[model samples]
Target chain A: MPGAEGPVGPRTDGGLGGGQRPRDRRRHILGDVFAVVCGAATLVGVVALAILLFDVVRDGVGQVDLAFLTSFASRFPERAGVKAALAGSVWILGLTALIAFPISVSAAIYLEEYAAQNWITRLIQLNIANLAGVPSIVYGILGLTVFVRALGLERSIISGALTLSLLILPVIIIAAQEAIRAVPDSIRQASYGLGATRWQTVSRQVLPMAMPGILTGTILALSRAVGETAPLIMVGAVGFIAFTPSGLGDQFTVLPLQIFNWISRPQDEFHVLAAAGILVLLALLLSMNAAAILLRNHYQKNRN
Target chain B: MVPSAPDLSFRSGRNRNERIIGAILFLCAALSTLVTVGIVGVLLTQSFAFFRQVSVVEFLTSTQWTPLFQDKNFGILPLAAGSFLIAGGAAIIALPTGLLAAVYLSEYAAHRTRRILKPLLEILAGIPTVVYGYFALTFITPILRSIWPETDVFNAASGAIVVGVMIIPTVASLSEDALSAVPDTLRQGAYGLGATKLEVSTRVVIPGALSGILASFILAISRAIGETMAVTIAAGNLPNLTLNPMESIQTMTAYIVQASLGDTPQGSLAHQTLYAVGLTLFLITLSMNVVSQWILGRFREEYE
Candidate 1:
């Protein structure tokens, strides 16, 4: 709060243009109060985050171990491990990436480079925006109906991955579009000047330039998919898979779903287990975000 | 004179490949539209089935949502009310704090301070909602119960508090972008007139970025309403129609998750209800998103 007043310039008129007036004093006091209030509000977020991290660590740190990473979930609180959930999450991440990445980048290329200014193009843009805002639970319902029921995928890992891919598609597409757009047009003109076709120019020049931005967006999107619970729940991610999934067709569970299951139990130890699960999930998220930040920084440095 | 007219064939092979690639990319772009169609198709068909069994009049007018009980009441009011309560409560907490934080970041914080603080706020945003749910249940719930002994173990207040914290980054980041978009000349002009920082922030910058600020508020609230895991975990499954934040309540999203967790046979009314509830949630959030996008577009165009 000490810096709430910011860097005050040397008083231009002896502290105030109208320091002798009571109204001036009140106005200055009001300014100081507002600044402090704003500073407090900003600190509120930081403090809340610190407390959350501290609380989870205090409850779950002791539970994290190699054994916890290898064993399957169990009814006993001490034995319940995150192996199945972690494996399923990794599977979801890889498959969602494989499924969503190329398609999203392609879409971004088409929209940014190929599409003309027309209503159809505008509608697609709007649709992507709306899809980005649709609740994850709704995407789950779509997955449940289309993949699990209609396509007979059952409660398989593939079904969940497909759902997550669709859920994150809009996000990736938007990010990819922005990245593509940011690729200076001069690069394309140079390629075309050499008699390169549109596709050739895009593939060789623009995409390479946009890769960092796209990967950062994709990592962030996938991290979101990993933390997602509701959609997977709808897509049939069971809470108590006795074995880790061996194939895409196998029923699966992810870390957040595992955490939810633990939290739902009335037992005290299970709550602690949930906290531990959160710690694991947060660890994964942090790494993905760190990678993104690194990529972004590298990109920024290259730009400069 | 031109060295026997250099071999400048049409190169139909390359042109064909280019056209093929273009079509494929266009198909990729069109896939997003297909996804939107798929969501609408699934929700409508299933919801229509649900409506056939439960009349719209009963579904909308009934106050209770006890579909699992023998005396089934199909009213959606309780679930909608719960979603509203959480979203509204979260908005109350996030809006002012988020806006103030944005003001501070844009107007008061020094360049280095803003750079450090912005990413810290983003870390809060990047955190998974499930973790927030865990924190709400374990940390915030206890704190609330200590002050208000009447509070339920799973209360709306804790859910709202955690969700509000979760979205503070969204509000702050978006609003800071808006606030920063206002031309520096406006602030300089106000400073030249001897207006204080607070006066310039409140009267000049805020009004200039009002539409963008409102859009962020709407998007944040929409996020709060659609928020699933945290609310589902912190706010219990009791679909009670009441205004008391101390009581446990079920949101529409929570209902979707709860119903999905239970194995309802295909074609059963309980299964159909999930789609119905999902459809309702979809419509509300979609409309809010559209409005937010509209406001954002208008604001951007104004600056352009």
Candidate 2:
């Protein structure tokens, strides 16, 4: 619909008036070239992703089996399994979700519905933003000192979960805040009009409306925690554990850490094992993401 | 109104319940602020202990970072240089490609194409960084070895390339959001002025979204600097002070990982170095994030 100014009114003086500008033609040609280049630039991500996936699958797909899933890590690539790592990942994700969900959602609710507009609120918001941007490795140091040493939690699943919960708290809080804010103010007004208290309105109206989005965000954050290795390592998760963690106080190893250990070795077979480990981790991450996306889509479709 | 006022005290119990719930939620929100304080507290105390052992001048000016070795030098330059080298290389790759991809998505792609490509990019973004690390070590390193023949088993170039690819989705999506935020009327105006599509995209939309684009760039670079697994896997643990991408180098993050992977006694100087490096990393990224947020806030154009 744009560029609709009609061609120069019919060349009354007519010596090829509309057709003879070489510079304009060159400009158009340049524009066309740029468009092609831009499209190609977009394909860079596609190509990289495709190649990475293909490479991982080619190397590791043969290694994924029942044995690989059941055995503990071994020096021999063929004998190594992800049993301990998988179990640890499950434990961490579950514990992290349990610890982080309530805190993040309640924080979101407070910031959205209770915090007054003032400098203190602004500062708190800014601090949350900063914390969200702080590197995960920095949080690793914090975990090492505060959780592992000071609190004497040692290198355990609960410590790892607590550290990861802190790492992801800001992300989930921001996401939950967005979801809560999307609930219409009229919902709150209606609840109040019905003699409901403020907490009652939020608990009965706003939370349900926002639950889908909050869950989606929380699920995504947990997946991120599952992928994280640096903070876990800092908190003493670097042991060569031969068994799955039996309790929160037990030492643990997650998939990414196992993968890191494998890839760091010089043997090509270890690399293959790393690739397989990667396959499992990616499967976990992608499925979690897919579920979140599905939930979001389902809710959106229902709303529409 | 007077009749309603007669029974206001009947709701005291509910009001008290609401106040208690509100306080709980407020504490939940305050936990984020507490986390920030905890990180600062832990970093400062540990870094102070490290500095007491190793002078600040030595930490700042010494050339070597062999803290783990018998001949210990505590200079941070090598690690800092390595981080900058990877970040610089990543910037060279991600900035142009990401911006161009954003331009294409914002200005040229059809709706269906955008829909398909956007999700693909999200998938790319969501892939675990450790998986990216695996790809960098196994896939990109092999490719580089074949091409350059002088590439190390672990080189900065390979890490940079993978980190760049990992961040492309981030830069593309954020920049696209900024470009899309530019009003359509501006595009139509440019087209009415007889500007070609590329010209309008470059000269109008991009400038209008400059702050957001810049913020995204800064954020992407911060991510590149703080990125751990991919760099640790692709870039070796040698803390070389040189800028050559072909040579293996260790980043500050990689150092933290390496240190954590090794057995160091608690409260030891070697253990304390992790906090020092982490503090430097945190300060760098935190400032960049703050500046990015400031740019977004200070210069954003509000459309009526």
Candidate 3:
């Protein structure tokens, strides 16, 4: 519709302003310019990301070493490290995966395999979709009320992990559902023909077949959960944690929280440290995403 | 399709186990519904308490957003203005570039190029928002200051630009799917004529995928609205009623984080204001997401 006039009445504009051959030549030039511009625009994001990585690496490379990784947050920016936040991030990621993975897989199994095509199932499906789209901050509010206050978990690592578990649950559920659905139904029928139970067919045949996809989804979900800050901020990830959290009940901060705190400070040294912290976070995220991609490629390769 | 029941020859023990697992799975599926109910209940019940103190009419009509100020004005317009301004600014940047990228990928790129570029774009999506926030505050704002000399260190412009870059992948991927959804036959038909690549993409593919393209726009805008960490770190926490991105302003989610991080006592008006704002944010994103999904599904064309 946009360029409809181009084909239908190419001569109209030409007739009004210029000769036909000149107009066609101008159009050719415009088309080439448009193509180049579009191509350049496509790479703008990639370029921006490259600049970002370069900027952080330049500012942070001097600060990243074994000491930086092992030290705790300090008032002196030079001495500050992300030990507490890194441990807390690990704790949250592990616990969120522990809490969310089995439940999400089971939910996907129910939705894709067991639940009949009824309004209840439809409602559940819609709810999950809507939940996935809800802002992560809202989940933080829910955690503050239900887990922190009602359940008396305090602002502990477990509470943060539980909140994040809810935040990533729908994503995992949707991804797991997609994976489960991709498993050939013929495999299910074959298992059934062997007198296997429904659960037997799913756990033994379907889940194993869908395992790589599930793993890919789980890694991606965890990567997202790891990077999130607002909900953790809302649920009380500390600005400065001097001690590494050793248990679920321990107080904690995460990499994003540490980065957020340092960035907000006025000290130039803190900003550099924040850049270093960002480098660490990005490294963690990149590894996770790389794992997901490798898993997906391997799955695709096997399928082919 | 599933043969309506399990094989009759399955052992009774396994059948019992299957039924239990099915029930467990059903419960797991129901948990997401419960999450929605919890979110709504938390937002509404707390907002109701807030409204009992501050009338709904005042909250909706007043422009001042000084909840923490001594005067204690609880109007949300200032926050809304900031959120929309950043969102609008982000849409301005992301929409066209992302659409162009999608068009290029869908119409021009070879299979190998697409395969590499698609995941490269996803790498942008996988990066943490806090890192974007850091880049916005440290990198983008300084660039803006060099350009204008008057841009505030924590202005909305840098936040918007980084947030825009952050969301480009979402827009690009979604729009690419929409454009690719346009039947290849249509593309071939256009090419069978003397239409140039630009003409075919602009006139045929874009128009055919317009609904889905618009859906991507809506989705991208919604994501911008709900984004927290970048806005929080770079947009500043001053709730002000203005459209200028050069000025620092607080957004709804940022205010929620600010409010939650404070020493606001439980059941106090300041504390309750968090939920009220959360409710408003929830409604806005919910409507946007619903509208996008409707457009994506309703106007979508399916072809083998």
**lDDT tens digits, residues B42-103, model 1?**
99999999998899999889999999989999999999999999998999999999999999
lDDT of 3 at B147: 98
Each model's total of backbone clashes = 0, 0, 0
- Alpha-carbon runs more than 4 Å astray in model 1: A1-19, A294-304, B1-10
Model 1 has an lDDT value of 0.91
Q: Once superposed on the true structure, which residue ranges of model 3 sit more than 4 Å away at CA?
A: A1-24, A293-304, B1-11, B301-304
Worst 10 residues of 1 chain B by lDDT: B1-10
RMSD of each candidate relative to the true structure = 3.7, 3.1, 4.3
Off by over 4 Å in 2: A1-20, A297-304, B1-5, B301-304
* Backbone clash pairs in model 3 (N, Cα, C under 3 Å; residues 3+ apart or in different chains), count: 0
Q: Is candidate 1 or candidate 3 better by lDDT?
A: 1
**Cα error of candidate 2 at position B8, Å:** 3.0
TM-score of each: 0.95, 0.95, 0.94
lDDT at B110, model 1: 86
Predicted structure 2: lDDT: 0.89
DockQ preference between candidates 2 and 3, better one: 2
lDDT against the true structure, per candidate, is 0.91, 0.89, 0.89
